[model samples]
Target: MKKPASAVPAKKRSFMEFMKRREGQRGLVIVLFMAIPLLLLAVFTYIPFLKMVQFSFFDMKYIGDRTFVGLQNYIDVFKRDDIFGALFVSVYYMGGAVVQLALALFFASLMVFKVKGDAFFKGAMFFPYLICGIAVGFIFKFFYARGFVLDSLLQLLGMEMEDIPMWLQDQRINNISLAATSVWRYTGQNMILFLGAMMSVDSDLYEAASLDGANKWHQFRYIILPSIKSIVVLNLILSISGSLSAFEPPYVITNGTMGTGTYFVIMNRLAHENQKVGLACAMAIVLLAIIILCTVAQKLFFKYVFDDGTADESKAAVRRRKMEEKAAKKAAKSGAMAQSSVSGKGGQK
Candidate 1:
């Protein structure tokens, strides 16, 4: 008996055939294009991250003989109040990130309307982001120095130098002042991102909404927000992670002193200053896990509420299905009636 068609195995392509096809050729070229980046990503990014994870489980310094002490480093990380305290500083940074994104969105919305001198305004706003992190640190240090630029500016505004609080030395608001520097630097960058996402939204939708007598707020809530949801979520994740990894401003300006020590700053101090490499790695891993967890939670939340938590199927598809089912039932009913009528007529005759 001959084998059925379904029983036959598909022929595998030979190496020559794979190289000869246009698609295969293009894929080979694309693979080559991406090869260097993949290599660099693996070498620099993945390798180091893996090393950090490995180091977290062992008792080792940067230059000492390694000893396997599983989970002790992680335990040690949690035992220290100072480390926990430093991590708490990240809350200020996270708060700043929220305010930063808000300001960015507000400005982005304004710029989208294309006011006069928008080009100049956009450039001016974005200029701060272009400044180097170290440069911003140095600039803000001087700006915040006592009886310096900030105090002078306040004096010019009719506030006495004595009345103005010290920007960096004051423990009550030093972290906030540092966080403000970060906000100033990154808000414009975020605004540009929001602007780009907003611009990509279909203009026809906006016109249609306008025709429907929808005001700007209504259009933004209904159309703009939905369209830019992915970008906004992406920025939120970035902002959260950035806040957790904050270092430069506090590190450079305050040197992690005066209650301004952040998680990363404290980690740096441990790894380099105290030579607690394993403990630092453990802290890094813990922080990484926290960020990953938050990101995943946010993703799940956004996924669940996508499309206003309406029916899973598109409205058009749902309507079409209902129509088809109704038509089928109507046809079946008509057929049954006709058959019964014929049977009754035959019996009567």
Candidate 2:
């Protein structure tokens, strides 16, 4: 006797049939086309990284061929006394990143609150990000070159134009000016990211908190803070990486000078002045290690911060399932009522 149709392994057959279906076949072709660029990207990007690792083991010279140097280049960065000043400048650069990130978060919070003219405000805030870093550097350079603000302030204080402090001329003022320019350009991008993250948070949570007599500050502290914790971690990582790898702003403004330049950052020191390819690779590796450590620290920090928190993956899943179940029941009940009405009409007729 022949077996029933349902007893056959129809699932595997159906999957294979679906693969051959015309609609899915076009999607498969499109997917392959999209994947080609991704394959090229992985090869070009990761192959260079691997080559850099190999180069870091060799003593690269300005002239002729390179010799094997092992870890000597890395040792120089840590052990050299001359680099101490640059290291100090790296701390100052960190200060710049912190200022940029904090201001970005503050502005993002304001934008998330649905303030008046929010669209225009967001566009104005983010306009700087559209301009090139070099352009920003030169624009600020011109702004400082004018000496108008300084001269005016000095004049108000009963002093002449001669008494005004030159912005780019002095080392301390130059660093601060570079940092301010960097912040002006990059903070908008960060603010947009934070705003996007804030907008995704559950509105119901905010409502619940409000119902519990939580004010705006309390809601922010209890609800908004916990919801956007992941974004904060992400921004921290970006800020740290950007701080460690800072180059364009100082390079443009100060022309790579010692005190005035951001080339004090390890990556900058390795690339421009030192011209040590091996050491630069080693620096890249060190920076990579630092980033990893920071990510781990952030994970721990988030765990600690969220210790008293309410959000959980399993709880969210349960809530979603219950909502879906309720919707399904309501749909089934409506269908049953419609069918009953049709049967009653047929009997009456």
Best model number under TM-score: 1
Give per-residue CA lDDT, model 2, range 175-273, as digits (tens).
Answer: 677777778888888889888877766566667778889888876665566556667777777777676667777777776574754433545666556
Candidate 2 ranges beyond 4 A from true positions: 1-35, 81-84, 146-164, 202-213, 263-275, 306-349
Q: Give the TM-score of candidate 1.
A: 0.78
lDDT of 1 at 342: 31
lDDT of candidate 2 vs native? 0.69
| Least well predicted 10-residue stretch by lDDT in candidate 2 | 340-349
What is candidate 1's CA lDDT for residue 307?
33
Which pairs in model 2 have colliding backbones? none
Candidate 1, which ten residues in sequence have the lowest lDDT sum?
A: 340-349
TM-score of each: 0.78, 0.70
The per-residue C-alpha lDDT of model 1 at residue 155 equals 97
Off by over 4 Å in 1: 1-35, 305-349
